[model samples]
Target: MKAAHAAWRGLEPVHGMIYFVPEARRRYAELGLSGRAGYFTSRSAAFGRASVELVVSTFYNFNPDLVRRALDGAWDVTTPQHVLDARYAAADEALRRAGLHELPALDEVVALTRRAAESACEHAQGRALFAAHAALPWPQEPVLRLWHAQTLLREFRGDGHVACLLSEGVGGLEALILHAATGEVPVDFLKASRAWPEVEWADAQQRLRERGLLDGDSLSADGVALRRHIEDRTDRLALPAYAALGDAGCERLAELASAFGRAVVRAGLLKPG
Candidate 1:
């Protein structure tokens, strides 16, 4: 797991696997990496190839194996369900790879989507977000995926460190939350994640105050109330659409999404879907 350990330098809950797990004592000897022994149960998708995969959504693609492990983690078992859960997740992953499933096992946060939309409404006083791209050159992830995750342990982290930031934070993070009661500044993923000297937090705070977006150093009462309303409705219905997936099936979704995202990117969609 040296490579895996290196990958998730700043990320959390990193799981990895060695091709063979002949018990906890000799795995490191086989892999030839000297570290604490992170033995693989059948649950270690991070340990096995195809056992692990990417988890994806309309806006993001994640390691599916990661999701599988996450969900499985929700239920603690006294009877050792690791292998059974792994099998189930793998089956689900396989089915998804075949393009049969439409949604993720993870529930959708419609409130986030709606809030993003509302951010547009609040900031759409002059023009659209930007000139719509006539065509964007989409890029597919190489078939040989970067089977790695890392976390960056930096004290004063800043933009300009894409690999470190993503390794530590969300794969795609917009600095100016489209929904937050901040300034009208719209920092795209690139800008939010990459850093902009001009877009400091202090300036954003001032704009939020002057724009009547807040009152007495706080968001307007209406903004607070409306945000909660959206959250409540979305929470009530936000359950995993693919709760029935087996391990293989969930892996399938990750594999399919990886391929599809690449395809969509290559097709040069106006934007990353």
Candidate 2:
């Protein structure tokens, strides 16, 4: 089980870097987006083109009005399929540019990823968070299937994370505060990226401190323990997808994908944390 969890986490960067890599951002910009804001806005437009409220409700943690502002006229710039293609292309180019395009193990990773994603999709039945993505069409290309699978896996866990946070009575700002306190992301980046207001951010800090989750500017010992518990719970919730791979399969997937993930990291395709 632990190996399965590790395999999923290990492969995360291979697909997840598209959102943060500068090359990918450039690709989105080429698609008529202004910059990162346009990228996130147009990319996350996958929750159906209804209204900002619908996106905000499903997305969570992001400021509502900021979501509205970012998504304003997003569809006019690019469609979801186009955005997905560009993201995939960026990853593809980065991998190729890094000389990984011809790697022998990549195809194995893709096959394993697709299988894992299929298992996850089967398990995703009736899951509200995954329903939106599950309803989307799958690509025939092996690499694209890998990306799609990772996306579903991410959303599956993301939706679970939101549930966990909500159960703890935390919302957007508080969630950011807790994340910052955990030292996973800096407070400045959290505030700026999420467009959190100063007054509300301060209030959230006070609230976290009251909950014994914040000590000065860091997470308290108790806070660390609590956050670990939440993460562990979320991991357990996501176990079924990995379970389909079985223990040996999980280890092999991780072993095969680790090099590619490392290449992505070394190429600076992901931001330094």
Candidate 3:
């Protein structure tokens, strides 16, 4: 379980860096998106069958109206499927163009990723978000299939994470605020793309303060502990996907994936925070 979780952790930085990569940003800009709003909406539509409302409710955790606005902007630029296709293509292309494929053991890494993702999806059958995503037709290409599989694994874990958050009485904006307080993600990034109204954001902040989770812009010690608990539970919830791999398999997968992650970092695609 530890190995599987660590393997996922290893691949995560590489997969997630697609959003931060300049090559991806340039591709979105070509489609008329001005900033991160365009990137979020267009790229998120990779789950083409899921509604904008579902996207907002699950992954985004942003204002629905603002999400709608972003989707509208996205449609003005391209169709939903087109947006998804372009995003998949762009991210994949960025990796290849950056010469990541040339790295030693990358083929083995992709194969292991495919294996892990396939196993995770099989276990994810009844999961709401994963089920929704799984209902989509498979992509023809290898790269696209890897991307879709990775997406399913992520959403499956994310749905479980949301369940954990709900059990802890944490809602969407509160979750984001807590994440910010933990200093994991940048505050500006969260505040900018989430599109919460000033009143709503302030209200969330105030509520966190009342709960002893916030001290101005930072997390109180209790807040940090709470956030850590949330993350620990989230990791636990995600372990089942990796548990199928066993310890050695997971360790090998993590070792291979780390190479790709390093390639991503070396490409200057991810910005330091």
Q: Give the TM-score ranking, best first.
A: 2, 3, 1
Candidate 1 lDDT by residue in tens digits, 40-147: 232232222222232122112223333444334222321223432333333233323433234342122122222222232332221211111101111122111111
Superposed on all Cα atoms, the candidates' RMSDs to the truth, in angstroms, are 20.3, 2.3, 2.9
> Candidates' TM-scores?
0.21, 0.89, 0.84
Model 3 segments more than 4 A misplaced: 26-37, 73-77, 125-128, 135-146
Worst 10 residues of 1 by lDDT: 147-156
TM-score for predicted model 2 compared with the true structure: 0.89
Best by lDDT: 2
lDDT (CA) per prediction: 0.28, 0.74, 0.71
Question: Over 4 Å off in model 2, which ranges?
Answer: 125-129
Better of 2 and 3 by lDDT: 2
Alpha carbon lDDT of residue 249, candidate 2? 87
The most accurate candidate by TM-score is 2
